[model samples]
Target: MARHLRAFLGADDATLARRLTAAGTVQAVLDAIRTRLSEPARDALVAELTAATGGLLEEDLDSILLSGLLGYHGLVDAARQTAAEQDMTNLVTLDHHLVRVTSEPVVEVLVDRQQAYELRLALTVTFTVQGLAATVRAGRLVHVRIGRCSADVSLSWAGQALVRHSDLVDAPLVIKLGSGVPVHEITDPADDPALARGTARVPGPRVAQPGS
Candidate 1:
């Protein structure tokens, strides 16, 4: 009975599409945005303390910025894991058939210190797996590359605007997906879109950093 249902569902493109759609596969990716991306963004903001901004206001600003990036990256990591899990489930349920999976994740990071400092990051990450199901089932290296990611970053202190980047999309994040290939990560400079284009925005007047 179960086999018959699976066969009936997978027998045609329209049936398969409907079955996949009803399974709410994309929703799994969305959930990962909240579960996985927060830590890196928050951690990045804390790392900004390397600059030692001094006064309370400066400290608040530093915290917001570093933490924001940390949380963003963390979320990206989680999303990658979730995507991989979804792919694995698809492979098992659908056999070795190839399928295209796509998800657009929109995340907003807001770190506020009352009236002292505030950091807001509106980010959109386009995650896609174009027929990697076959490679995955065959135990081969699969590249799960993010399509296009855009970020609108804004920072404000004492009711004043400091820095802002609207629709910054030069660097796109990519995750190498497969067994023994390391989970989704931005380790390589060539693979890290955020590092390749530039570091995420930190609160302050945009000044030239040494390597940025």
Candidate 2:
């Protein structure tokens, strides 16, 4: 009987409501069933009904009364709370990180040769913290703080690569170059005796110089 009751109550909302109405008025049907059962049997059946309904049954009702009242209420409030917490746990925020470089005269030749010339160059400098990560929209900045700058000089010029982040400012760079040689190098005059040491001035942005 409990199984049949559960099945009837589990029907779609419209079917359950129609069957409940056709059986007789809900209160009249429950009163008839309650009068037929003994007190202990009725109490035991109500306990079973309470358990079957997951504690949703009223304490005063017999099983038949509860069975008559059964109606689906959508999701349980506890289940909804758990689902909300799970969604919060699944949410995440992404972090942002990027690299950049900035400088003046976006493109410039720090050194140029007339006809054909070849010579070693050296760079000694300190870079501003801002300069290291500043955006580099165009061209490249080479540091020649250490080692020999050697290249062949000719109409068809050859260039040499400079060492970057080398602490040894006095180190010489050797390079081989040919005619019409063009080289771009960075140096801190405050660190180079030949450039006449003084407070170094930071250069601002400028249009690319002609011939650069």
Candidate 3:
């Protein structure tokens, strides 16, 4: 299970997390994010706000109010981006050191499936489903065995099947496998095929600050 624990760090992941977490309330974080928007974005937001308020917009808008609206907009954009990443089956972040959502989705799905398998295995070990079962053993999902009472006898043999799926694989060296393994890689849309895709897109995470 420890091996399964992985984290992804895009640009400002630490700072963004800290800012968001340290805030006393969610509203505070939203306000901080509003000030980070570009001038054009800010003006557009103001215009949008004016339209929503039906021309009675305050001559002097409250900064906190304005930021609350802007922060909502930013969160909306972030959600859209997250959805796009899922649709693309990729989450490309700048830091190569951290596991990209793109890279981990496949493995994550595999680990999740194990939970399902564990439930089925429990039924197989006992004729009746009673009590609780733990999928992980000794901080590792491998060789997981679980049962209580009569089920314990069956688990001794049946629960040995669960094991962690390995992510490693050989490409340049293969034996009777499919050719051109497709070396799945990420690239920004702006990057040309001839150029390294890695060099094209910048990665950064959003950080909101406390209310100004």
- Say which candidate scores most in lDDT: 1
lDDT of 1 by residue, 23-138 (tens): 44223323433333354543443333211111111112111221232223333444455565754421211111211111111112222321222222122222121222112322
How high is the CA lDDT of each candidate model? 0.28, 0.22, 0.21
TM-score of each: 0.23, 0.14, 0.13
Query: Model 1 compared with the native: what TM-score?
Result: 0.23
In the range 1-212, model 2's lDDT, one tens digit per residue, is 11222232233334423432343322232353434544554344333322322111112111221111111111122223434453321111112111111111111111111111111222222211111111111122111121221111110001221222222111232112212111122222212332221111112223468899
| Regions of model 3 farther than 4 Å from truth | 4-19, 23-27, 30-180, 184-212
Question: How many residue pairs clash in model 3?
Answer: 0
Which stretch of 10 consecutive residues in model 2 shows the poorest summed lDDT?
A: 102-111
Name the better of 1 and 2 by TM-score: 1
Comparing 2 and 3 on TM-score, the stronger one: 2
Candidate 2: regions farther than 4 A off: 1-29, 32-35, 55-212
Best by TM-score: 1
